[model samples]
Target: MLVDSHCHLDFPDFAEELDAVVDRARQAGVGRMVTICTYLSRFDRILAVAERYDDVLCSLGVHPHQAAEEIGGVTVERLVELSRHPKVIGLGETGLDYFYDKSPRDIQQECFRRHIRASVETGLPLIIHTRDADDDTMRIVREEAAGQPVKGLLHCFSSGRQLAEDALDFGFSLSLSGIVTFKKSEELRDIVRDVPLDRILVETDAPYLAPVPFRGKRNEPAYVAHTAACVAEVKGVDAAELARRTTENFFRLFDRADPSRQAAA
Candidate 1:
């Protein structure tokens, strides 16, 4: 079975059809999903979603885009505190995003560092979101990880091969999103082909970036199969094997998520 390692089920896009969305995911062989909390203030809503669905786990942190708004509130202490929940499996869909510049670069870096510290303290793998800031992202992850060994996954990775190589060197996993299925993502597909299967994971980042044939449409966890199939084809492996390997990789990186818990669900 496949696992959608990152998604935002709390988003209003799925509000009325969450049950149906999840059912579709199950029917598509997506046995589990991890809903991401982009803003700490709305964590209760995110947590409530996780509590409602046994197969849906979650992460906590402030997205880089919202860093300025969460200043003084996105503390390592607060992140560690919220992460104590049994279903909170990771930290920070957080990292640099120079593409949007939604928040000042410095503030985003500071917030990213705090989340990394929280991940180190909590022993939860960090869920990173990076775009057009590979140098800074790499430097911060490498610097902070040097002080304290940390585990993390580069979520929705669509960066340069050098960044992918650097992150892998730091012992981090790369999660592929529906973007990789786009026809223009030849570079990304090349990166996927080179990445070791054991260090790969799959996600939909649903309500956005739906895979091919479903492009320009609202994405859901069920569509992870298409992304997985694309990655599998690029890697010269069968879809089922890719699912098994990515599921294993998911559990390995997000160790806080219990496999038995999914079975029980």
Candidate 2:
């Protein structure tokens, strides 16, 4: 079965039809999903969604865009505390996002580092989101790795080859989103072609970045299959094999969400 390793099921876009959306995902063969948290203030909403669905899990984080606004309230201790919940499996969709620069670069960097520290302490994988700040992102991740081994997934990856190479070098998995399926994403497809199959995961980043045939439309976990199919083509593997590997990679990185663990529990 496939897993939408990253999504935002708590967002209002899905509030009206969350059950249907999840059902459609199951119908499309997606067995699990991880709903991401962007703001510490909205974490209750994220947690509520995860708690409601057995197949859904959540992450605790402050998106780079909200770093400044939430910086005062987001501490490594607090992140670690919230992550103690069974449904909270990862940390931060957090990193640098120079493209928006909604938060000051320094604050974003500080927040990212704090989240990294929390991940180190809790042993939970980080769900990183970097955009137009590859150099800074790489530098921070590399610096943090020097202190302790850092492990995580680069969620909705749509960055340069250098960042991709650096992430893999640091033993972080790269998650593919529908962005890789766009007609103009040849460069991204090329990057995927070169990335090792074992280091790959697939996501929908739902309510955003829908794949072709569904492009410009509201995306959902069900659409991860399209991204998987595209990546399979790039990797020269069968679609089913790609799904199996990515799902396996997802569990390997986000072990808290592993089905085997749940079964044992």
Q: What do the candidate models score in CA lDDT, each in turn?
A: 0.92, 0.92
- lDDT (Cα, tens digit) per residue for candidate 2, span 42-119: 999999999999899999999999999999998989999999999998998999999999999999999999999899
| Each prediction's number of clashing residue pairs | 0, 0
TM-score for each model: 0.97, 0.98
lDDT of 1 by residue, 16-122 (tens): 99999999999999989999989999999999999999889999998999999986798888988989999899998899899999999999999999999898888
TM-score winner among the candidates?
2
- Where model 1 places Cα greater than 4 Å from the true spot, the runs are 260-265
For each of the candidates, the C-alpha root-mean-square deviation to the true structure, in angstroms, is 1.8, 1.0
Output the lDDT of residue 7, model 2: 93
